[model samples]
Target chain A: MNAAPSASKEEKNAMSSMETPDAELVARVREGDRNAFRKLVERHRERIYRVALGMLRNPDDAMDAVQEVFIRVHGRLTDFKGESAFGTWLVRVTVNYCIDRQRRQKTWDARFVVDNEWEGVSEESPEHQLVNAQIGEALQRALAELGEEHRTAIMLREVNGLAYEEIAEVMGCPKGTVMSRLHHARKKLQVALRPFLEEAGERDLADRAGEGVRRRE
Target chain B: MNDQDQEKLSLFLDGALAPEDAAEVARLVATDPEWKAAHRALKLSGEMMRAPVEQAARSANFDGLWAGIEGRLPAPERAPSLLERLRAFLTPPVLVGLAAAAAAAAYVATRPAPTPAPASPSPGLAATPRIAPAPESALAAAPADASEPVVIEGIESEGSKTVLVSQPVEPGGTTVIWLLDAPDAAGDGAAAPTTDDDPI
Candidate 1:
């Protein structure tokens, strides 16, 4: 009887460990459970790093921002009332910190100005690889040129894959505002990337024509 | 493109437009050359946007990051310091002292003035003024009267002089009083009675 109860208890503990929700982990952290807090950090660290990277556009700055975000989250964990999802709260904290950091450094205008050295894509056809690299560099340049608000909206929506509502919550704006920002951001990006897009389109058309000639011959 | 169409296109790209609206947008994109170009550009831009930020150069050190955050966390509750313990011990007494002082001042300010007894004037002494005693019931019932000046007879007494102190209990108000003292003709030949008629 004692052995059966002990085994069942172990199984229950394993089940809980496997399925603990963010809210549960947050509650445990609030109860001074350091292990639970560590688990929370591990769960959200990658996304936080990405969001920070998207905003700061520098890896070292992004990593630093993530560290600061987690430190703040730990300090203010008790202030979390569970009114919004923990991830939404975390994103909000991360974005605000990144934005503030950018503003203080006064380097918002200078971000992404330098062309990222193109890394070779080995698996793709040579022509396609060149086109893809050009397009990627152009896109990065266009994103850097966008105003901070527009860039942030795009980053939160695209890089982080946050839904419109979640984006609104993280941005502390209405859903309509998030949509509007995304619209403007995309428009600006489209204008900036138009040359690259045209180049890619022409390359595709030429490749198709060459294929047709080869087949006919 | 018009603002409305641009908005719809943005929403469509985000998969945020309603199904019916999305269908409309799709039809427009297929039929209109300008819309087609706009949609193509937006789609490519979005695809580029979604590209993973290159992580090879700057892979996050999760363990180091966590250690930094954990280090900054407020130190866990520790044994109280001597100063903290002393403060905790003295808090109740300090609060009690403040309360007692406030209560005593309120009592002194609100108490009814005593009635002056009639006495025959002495040879060189001036007759004390007979001020009417304030109504105790009125004073007690109207706590708001605390702001009004209360005239207390005989706040201080020397051999032949009585000092009547009239002071406003409210903060930042002035205190006015009258001191009745006889002419000092017998104590010393050089000393003369000086009446203090100043409002303090």
Candidate 2:
């Protein structure tokens, strides 16, 4: 009995892996197939949610923005001409919605002074292998300090891993402007992270030296 | 750094520099400590920016999302079921007509022809009776009993003298009522009734 069930599970996994690619899935979504749309949301939601979270720096806001992004995509699926990758299109939508949310939050902050006092531990000690959890918290803090446009450009280029041109497309700006924003963003991040870099550098250098010596002998 | 070198360095870091430009940057970084330091700083910034840090926030829930979408859409109007539509298409309107014909046949099937009503002797008047009497004629001028036909019995005139008028009636139980009085003679000077069969 166990053998038969395991075999069936393996077969199902294999069959799923052989199923439609993202492009075909998107096409089916455009044809109004809800299941296909769900597949698309599943495939790209992680990156999209990450990008939104990076921009908004709040998980709740990111969730709302992601939901709005899908709703908008469903509304306009017929207009998607397949000129760009579905991932790229979704990332663009996600970025724009987050930026809008950021603007609204800023307006709210201006009228009512709300402090992010609950902003908790910026570092995760060894028990967490969570990549950049510490860095992410620190980055979020650093990002919170920048203007919305600059922060969004940085998130798009860095987190979404979009090329400068793609970022430009999403941002509705010239490539030169994108470069300017990114250049400024780097300067800002370096300023924010200088102490962390200083503390980590000496240790990283020592570890690298030990590895080099081990290789030599 | 020279403007050309700076441009080349930026392009190289971006992986957009041509092969020759890339080679030049690589050579400069290898040879010059200043170039190496700048390159290291630039690369570090790039990696820091690209750090795959925080895990993604949970994405929109599919079921909740669809529920919200459904809530926003208007409810569709109820349509007739397939069987009802099919039944409507099959039934003909003239079936009512068929039912009337069947009833008439059934009545004919059950009854012997009723004894013919006795015929009355023809009146002495030589002229054919009109479907409606001429308005100018005196006999036509008599106040007609709206409730009675030709020779109404037991009706006492509520006003001036009443005259029995003969009027042909239509087959489907339609009765024509006419009241004739001279405009000058009637106490209320309403206009004399016209012979014109003009519809009221």
Best by DockQ: 1
What TM-score would each prediction reach against the true structure?
Answer: 0.63, 0.52
Best-performing candidate as measured by lDDT: 1
Per-residue lDDT for A93-113 in model 2, tens only? 887787677677664121100
Per-residue lDDT of candidate 2, residues B61-152 (tens digit): 44565455445433434578999887776566666777888999998688542211112212221111113332445334334443334432
After superposition, candidate 2 runs with Cα above 4 Å error: A1-40, A58-61, A71-93, A103-145, A187-217, B2-10, B29-32, B49-175, B182-200
For each candidate in turn, the interface RMSD (Å) is 9.0, 9.9
